[model samples]
Target: MPEATEDLARRGDRAFLAIGIAVALWLVATVIVLPIVMPDGPSQAVTDYLGALRDGDVDAAYDAAGAERHDADAYDTSFLRSEALSTDWRIQSVWTSDDLSPYDAKLTGGIEPEGHETQPGVRVVNAVISHGDATSRGQFYVQETGSRDFILNPFVYADAGATLGFVDLNGVTSPAHRADNGDKLTKKDSFALFPGFYRLYQHNDDLFRADPSTLMVLPGTDVDISTSLSLTDKGNKAAAKAVRAQLDTCEKSTQLAPSDCPFNPLDDGAADSVDAYDHEYRDVKDIKWKVLVAPKFDIEPRDGEGPGDFELVPRNYATIRLTAVGVDIYSDSDKAKRFSTVCPIDPEDLVLTVTASKSFTVSGPAHTYAGRACGRDH
Candidate 1:
């Protein structure tokens, strides 16, 4: 054999020897060193707790941490909401330290908030809790009786109470669940919810339903859900019907005064003469009405009781527009067939203040939105 060949073989043998040593070291570390140095118990406890939560065994998870201040009802409702709204959480990392308690470990996971499905990585504190018994101290995400859970704090900003109960699209009411230990009614705002998806309706059939609207309750913020209600399709329909009823009274009027009809555009002098021409507002088209229901009870400074009794009366504003197909101005007084040009009654838009509650009742004199009459007026 050549000396060069022998030298190459010796080098290869040394390399193999180095690789073997490295493997041996790794084995030693995996079998002995890791066990001795890394505190797996804490990490394991965290895993067990997370598993319990994932399985909806909240009590088990709390028991694992020896949690004393466990409000099962509140926690259960909140957890259920979280689970329903959120996607599967993936464990990012699990770290343990000897300097910390044997049960102390830090865990990280990725989660996405409800509506934001495309994005992820909302980190929560999944740390191995070092409270209560030494054996269970390794448990993760546990809280004392009075203490708030870190995970829950981020999800629910405030316990909101609605003056009027809200019904979902399915007609499910807001106070969805009530538990002995965790009655949602006892909470402020009647709901402990963070801003997310909700469909709400007023109890009054006359009022509109808010369908699949996002209830914007910011985390760590308080809001009255009722203050921001909008008109539903049903509401718009009702409003249009009511306006047509009012128009019917106007259509059949002859005197053009309050006795005959509450709404008279001629009274405002916008029209030269409604009685002179035959005004037929059949199939009231392009009808637009939006009702904004606001907080009504006036906090008046009256001396009777301590800050006065709450008058159920609330005030709301209604914006309305009505357009007619034709307003016939005739040579003869008879409305039957004088044969005048078909004049379009442009949209008469009016904002009326109404004394409103569950239903909007026009408070003062009725408002009439009428376009131009035939004559140019002297």
Candidate 2:
């Protein structure tokens, strides 16, 4: 009897082991093999769409990626026929999740504005693409003064919490404009300067978009955003030589000659991205000369408080009337002037006259560009 009981128990254990192994094999096949074989939702669709786009079937490609682009509302197929679809732009990746269908790609990242002309060097992106492959390498004929991982933008010299209201450095002062003798914002101005946190904040409707239209003042010049950029890859001495040569041999008759001066015309007319310019600061084409509205506010004093209780604050509002007298910032890469030899403070834009009912910190001290480039309470 005991021997019979032992045989039965062994049989039951063997049956249990067999059932466990079968279940394990079935799970493995379902989890791993099925994903490899199946082409459903965004995955299968994204692959087909990318292939169609490459094959020049834009109609079919758009149909596939129609849901992913912001230009869908235009109702115009002709717009899609431009550069991003035809030339210089190509797909890098297309991701389709259960909820999102993102078309990722790299554009022939233009070294000039409008992203028209392509540069050399490859940069990758995982975001939704509407233009070209975001991974295309870039080789800029004219190296810009910034770093670009996915987005290309140049920066201006501004202290953190910097205000860029109009300032007259040519000895003329106005309520709308301040006078800095020679103060310069020391920050390297461009989205590419710090690519890590800056890019992630720029995505998803670009809620944290930083304005590239800011103007910077040269240290000591006191003029706002008026420094010229040098194009030649030579040091200070060599660049000075090149600029002198360029200024001498160039004919006045050439269309691009007179207009290419460091002091740009109000109607700035220059063409072709030279080593003397930035990709973002593309002359007067991308820039507009409009008035700024700077508003003012006052702090209310307490009833029992003395005169010290009253505080004067410039309300964060708007400023109007400051005009774009001239664009002094062109590429100084030819090395016309050293980056900055004088103090960053614009002596001309300094506090010429402060008229207020309440007294405050009257004038700032002489600032140097040698140290931190932030504001000196301007």
The per-prediction tally of clashing pairs is: 9, 63
TM-score of 2: 0.22
Candidate 2 per-residue lDDT over residues 253-334, each given as its tens digit: 2322122222221122334111121221222222221213322333322122121212223345322111111223554543
Cα RMSD of all models vs. native, in order, equals: 16.7, 24.9
> Residues 302-333, candidate 1, lDDT per residue (tens digit)?
11121111112224331212223323443243
Instruction: Give the 10-residue window scoring lowest on summed lDDT in candidate 2.
Output: 192-201
Task: Find the 10 residues in a row with the least total lDDT in model 1.
Answer: 301-310
Candidate 2, residue 180: how far the Cα is off, in Å:
8.6
Off by over 4 Å in 1: 1-6, 22-50, 55-87, 90-158, 162-164, 167-173, 176-185, 188-378
